[model samples]
Target: MRRPATTRAITRATTLAAAALVAAGSLSACAVGGSDDGPLVVVSTNILGDVVENLVGDEVEVMTLMKPDADPHSFEISAQEAARLRSADLVVSNGLGLEEGLQQHLDAAADEDVPTFVAGDVIEVLEYAEGDAAGTPDSHFWTDPARVLDVVDALAPVLADLDGVDAGVVEEQAADYRAEVEQVDAEMTESFASIPAERRALVTNHHVFGYLADRFDFEVVGAVIPGGTTLAAPSASDLADLVGAVEETGVPTIFAESSSPDRLVQALASEADVHVDVVELFTESLTAPDGGAPDYLTMMRVNTERITDGLSA
Candidate 1:
């Protein structure tokens, strides 16, 4: 549920007008303080920020525009925050239209000729639904470690191109990271393969696991949201149809996303008389530092364990 374009425009206009007024008076220093210098890396979402930070280590300063547990569809940056986007030397985004709210800022940054990289662009996409409608690619490629290996592959060259970064060092590190990703992918494949082929079906809140299912050869029976993004609401008929599908498919678990509430899925489970395990998979954003699914590697591992356990029974 993103704010309307009109609302965003008004907000941006009002903030800029206020900044101008303050600059004319006494608050100029406060207004200018947000433009401090560093490596000037701008990441679209927090999950990608964690990945980039792990790749770059302490070599560069990174800032994530989206906060922890923030919905990617609706998260908005302030005017001062938008200034950071403009001043950044490198901008990394999830792409695949994950940052619906910050698209204008991204476009403006592109207009200014800031170097931008889309992590999802490197990975092969899984389209759950078709057409120019909103939320098509599902944007949950990180769920599959294989797909994220593609991201790591793209990221190495991009980091090498940045100023003050050693291309050779980044290349070696990227190769090491890609090996790790491949290992994880192998582990996931083995783990998920344990679930009997008959039970290798998934029921989720939305179309979050298309990539994972495709990679591991699981059937995506149905989703409560009935769309690629969580922004779409399921109508009563849609819910009824989904419940029927769940009953027909006999999927033992209905997985839920870490960032989205699961009340609807719970209710659907109760009404359908099926055992729905609300497995918290990292669908949109990564968890906080102390949370279970804190980073990309851990997130995929935890999700794999959960999915395997839930389906094996």
Candidate 2:
């Protein structure tokens, strides 16, 4: 049975409250400049924040700066958030230039000798063309469930050390989540494999699917924005070239992120005189609880279904 949104929200709130209780003394210890019993981990993006919360469960106090649907690239942190970052026992960031606004806070925390984990650093980064300004290691690795399992593997030990938590329990939970991620990965692989190889190329607003393409053997021919970050605007010529590429490649689908407007891709599709499907994917942020891509697993599954169905059609 599908859980109601109110019930899910209440469940999430209750889980968070439990985690808060477990980490309260640890947070207090950190506030008093003493040894912390548990870790206060702050995630820069809500997507990573969700994964962190899942891995840690109710064992650690996990706070996220970016809310649901918040744009991670341009998100601004308030003074209270800055204080939270400063006092956090550990800080987890999506990294790879995803948190442009929170970089300073992360650096500040690093300066204070707090343990910081960049989830991107754990995965093999996919780089873009040399002259392309949007070429940074794509920060959306969690789009691939296997890569998220890798993150859970990396996060297990860090989460286990938090105060008021049983290390064994945390490790056990992490293992269980990792198994689930593996199952999701296998399912996605099978689902994506249903699409013929020739139809597997992807064109999106930005280079958000590097990990997915790499994992699933899909060719990312080009992006409308031609960069790693979505903040860059595509030049008229860039659009022309991308449209031309789309025409030549005959890829009927053009993906746009939930946080980005589809106007540019829509215009390009019209100009190219080809039918383009501008499917929305949860790239930088997860959808609201009631929306389609509320969690990591569902987000990837929805994206996979869209890509496979669109391209296959």
Which is the leading candidate under lDDT? 2
Clashing pairs for model 1 are none
Model 2: per-residue Cα lDDT over 1-313, one tens digit each: 9999999999999999999987997777676763344567898988888788878877777889998887888889899989989999889988888888778989999999878888988887777652275455777788778778778888788788766778898888888878878888888889998998888898888877778888889888788888877788888888888878888888878888887888887877788867877777777788789978788778877887888898899
Report residue 214 deviation for candidate 1 (angstroms): 0.5
* lDDT tens readout by residue for model 1, 188-292: 988987999989998877777788888899988878887776787888987888789888878888888877898888878887867666666677887788888
Model 1: residue 172 alpha-carbon error in angstroms = 2.7
- TM per model? 0.84, 0.86
Off by over 4 Å in 2: 1-38
Error of 2 at 171 (Å): 0.8
TM-score winner among the candidates?
2
| CA error at residue 164 for candidate 1, angstroms | 1.2
